[model samples]
Target: MGLRRLDIDRAALLTALTARDEGLLGTWLDLRDGTLRALVEPDDEAFEARLESESDHYVKVPLFTREFRLMAEFVEQVDDDELAVRLDQALAGPSAFRAWEGVLAADPSEQRHWRAHRESALEQWAASWLAGIGLTAPWTDEVPAPEVPALLALVMDGPVRRALGSDAEAHTTYVRACRDLCELLREPFPSRRVRSASRFARGPVVIERSGRDVTIRLRADDEAG
Candidate 1:
């Protein structure tokens, strides 16, 4: 008998994994990339064992941590090397980097989280760092739309520009701002049909029929136009 191919919802799993209080099983399932299916479900023991195995696999793979650690190290080293430079630059001008001198100081816990849980910590730190920089208000507080530009500018100068290359800051900020605004404007999920242009062109259309004589109309491209 042939082995059945594993089928799982990658998007759903990813969404679940990205949640603030995501469970280990969901994260593990996401890391597995739908190759392994959950049988017994998630618990601390299962989570720890899976996490350990995954961590071991990550170590062996090297690809997983190579770029992540390299970026993290680069940020850490750059922050250190440019500490004086940043201080001087801030002092000389009205740069946001210099403005938050007190907050720029590192927190060991956040650093540790960044090292251990790279993606989650990076996102959390992005928000926290923005808040710390006085760009936006506290995470718990209401964030005004006016604060977005300055907050985005701070992010652009800081990690977004540093880690992802210089050209991406504006684009990243725009995309994130759109997502944030969308969430703020609507419920978590809404029943809305989002159609892609390509799909809309190629997808099917439904036609309803009644018991009476039906009149069908099919128009050609030139006539329609």
Candidate 2:
């Protein structure tokens, strides 16, 4: 199969990626157009049915942690030692994030730096996640096509049928390979047999879908045109 490169929606992916609230209803990426549609109301049967019928085109977004970066981690990356100390100290109290925000708000330049720093990290993270799923980001260079699994080839493409011409051991191997692929796919993505993508085309990460197509843009990426 030819690798289909999609142009995805940037904002929607970023919204999912940068989400601090773990209490989302659910989110899915429509591969046909790279647009993400969130299921806000759990009982929306029409939307649920659409997702079910068109399951191949949609990938579910996993639960994410807001602790992608710790306050101390960001502080350590700061260029200024004094400011770093202040930032680090700010993490000591009850209103740590507020205190840290107070400091950054007082320093416009550093605040900009912090935002840029965080955004850059997020871009990289999102790009890596997408690339793992055989998608490309505009800023990233030379992403190869996705790897097809053994089960798809054996079951769908009739490789196991060909195994019938060979010895019993060969056919058994093929069956085992398909079983492994099934287990792998059932596993959690990255680790399991499933997972997610965000980046698309030569863009940052805005995801929009029209008809059977998706376009993603990176609105916050300074490097994205």
What's the TM-score of every candidate structure?
0.19, 0.56
Per-residue error for 41 in candidate 2, Å, reads 3.2
- What are the lDDT figures for the candidates, one per model? 0.33, 0.56
By TM-score, who's the top model here? 2
- Cα lDDT over the full model 1: 0.33
lDDT of 2: 0.56
Candidate 1 segments whose C-alpha is farther than 4 A from its true place: 1-8, 14-26, 30-42, 56-152, 155-225
Segments of candidate 2 deviating more than 4 angstroms: 1-4, 20-23, 63-70, 142-225
> Candidate 1: deviation at residue 159, Å?
12
